[model samples]
Target: MPASTREAVRTAVLADSDTRWKWGALTARRITPESVEPTGFVLRGRATPTARQLTETGVSDTAPREVTGAEFLREVRDAEARGEGYDVVVLALVGGAVRALLQGLADLGLARRPVIVTGYVGVVYEKLTDGLLLRHGADVVLANSRHDAERFRAVYEGVGASAEPVVEAALPFLGGAPHTPEAGRDTLVFAAQPSVPATRAERAYVLRRLVGHARLHPDREVLLKLRSKPGEHTTHLEEFPFQKLVRELDAPANFRLVYGHMGEVLDRTDLLVTVSSTAALEALHRRVPTAVLTDLGVREALGNHHFVGSGLLTSFDLLDRGLVPAPDETWLARQGVAADTPYEAAFDAARERVAALLALPALPPVTPYYTAETAPGYLPGVLARHRLDVTAPEPRESGLRRVVREAARGAYRQGVQRVAPVIRRLGEL
Candidate 1:
């Protein structure tokens, strides 16, 4: 087929959360040929990014369409029936959701379907085997680092499944100028996570430590870089937010909660600290001085255990003592930070892989490892959670009812995210 005869590649992405949306949209754009622009769809759910959250991500062009799982499937099926199907579809969803989508796609039984692509949003520190298995059917299951790629392949091959889909790629969101000493003011940023230090006591302790550090060094600016504000849903549920915890402490003017793009915050930052946020990777990629806190103990629950050999782990005490640690070069190479390598070239293999898959006559049905036969007890529950039942016909809805349903869903999300939290806090009081 000649390029002129064939229509341009049509790409679409479906993501469940804001962070996943960022990863999926950017990954789609990167893998797609330069001439094509990918469309983005936000899956209607609790974790769906608000307009403000999406804007903060800086992925402005796509203008994501919101869709329920059933609606998205119907759209894909209808498009394929019309012979105008998307060429590529990226599933930036949770593992169970990805599994459900795989089952749904498999059931569609289209003669031709989009080349499915899926991957993590960032440093995958937990649920290694389970997550990988759920995403096994994607045409390309991107591994965000060389370290991840190896582990992903090992998990699949160990389980007697094919590891062909795993592709080595750097995090799409990792980029910015290398750090240089700021002329006027020096900044130190603590990249906060939503639920890592899940308990209020733990979160409050961290906040008090940050405030203490700020009081100790008022001249050097200290920032608590928060992921989301109250009432805003992110990739994870923030049961105990740093914002509320900080209000209890008397802090210097230099210590403040700032929210926006993490890369932008890193720009002015002389030192970046975190328990285990992916922002640490971003900071390290920029060659900024970074530290992983051991004050919480190098525990798996906190996720700092993932940084065991990074040579960046330290306590606030060490930081207070003027300790600045350099990242181990070998570890950086394994993690695909590749400070010496061209960032653009990181996607070369992924692009080539996508191009090759697209060139095939027609992709076979998505064959996930956990079929009804393989995972009889567990498979149905996963599909049911997403409201995906391939055995039954998709429900029909009137336009008026759909409008009402979407509106209701929005209200429900707001109540859960905003109203419920306040009510709970009041109850506590």
Candidate 2:
């Protein structure tokens, strides 16, 4: 390909706040507009409302561009005609839609050479489908964790495709000035929202255990910081039996509900508690002692047990035995998680892998970008209640938008309500 032509063709296949920010900051590639015909389109399997929200807020060119199944099939055909046009197709997808998407891609002959970023592991069908995609088309598959990376590597051993870890760090919003730590407060927070019935049962059991432990140690305070989500004020709050539990038991004076200011809430807590939720990872990495509540069968099935089995996780069993793993003092001293090499080195390695995928006669590299200024309809705008230009207002905000802003408060209340009864009941146990 000629230099000028290659440069002209190197536009982003998908343009959204995250895609634009992630890829744009890393490389000079412009976010592809809906108006412009791409050499080929890249599709992610997950219907990530957040990604769509990013696109809705930040992506320029407001024309309504509806991509139907047929239109997508046509785009692939067009790309195929312009041979050597697309580096490769990429799909970061999961669940039922994956089959239809892959089948469609295959029918169009687009699945012959592409890259696939697989989601979490353990679902056999999803893993097998991902492996098949890799063998048939993918040049590179991105895993979000070291465990996920190793899992994918095992699945596709000896296959042409390769797996690499891309740890999902919290966005810059999380890095805002760390609040001052709260001293001498003995609180434990369960930050996850259990959406399923089975999960609720497990959570109930864990709360019971924690309450029992709290009763035995009357000197210590037990605080529950529950986050609220969409429909939470109605469903979760109403269904959870906090008030009833309080009425039933001779409650400890220290057991109270704390909400709001998550960083502060966490700072006050002696430790964080959860099932197989990512909050465990966040808490430990940030120097908070973490306990994995393993009695939850659902969480255990989802690989929470592995963390407990690993030295990294301190289990509820240990906590019941009066154990508390010290905070990651090394990371706290350095003010960051451990890396054998510096961040720049890890980034360099990531860039090399991305470059390798791009250089492959098969797939285009994902160039991620971030800018300090707000673009039209960008995330900052949506979150801040401003327009894309960072000026006007939209009529309504998304449910998720509301949730992220208010989750800590809601979760804290719910956790207190749910745990109070269990604590009182522990005497019977």
Query: Per-residue lDDT for 303-391 in model 2, tens only?
Result: 55545333445656777677866544443323223333333332343334444544455443322111123223332332233111111
Clashes of 2: 23
Lowest summed lDDT over 10 consecutive residues: which window, candidate 1? 1-10
Best by TM-score: 1
Count of steric clashes across candidates, in order? 0, 23
Q: Candidate 1 lDDT, tens digit per residue, 133-221?
A: 98988899999888899999999999898999999988999889999996887899999998888877888988999889988898989
TM-score of model 1 vs. true structure: 0.93
* TM value for model 2: 0.50
Looking at model 2, report the run of 10 residues with the lowest lDDT sum.
Answer: 26-35
What is candidate 2's CA lDDT for residue 398?
90
Instruction: Report the CA-based lDDT of candidate 1 relative to the real structure.
Output: 0.85
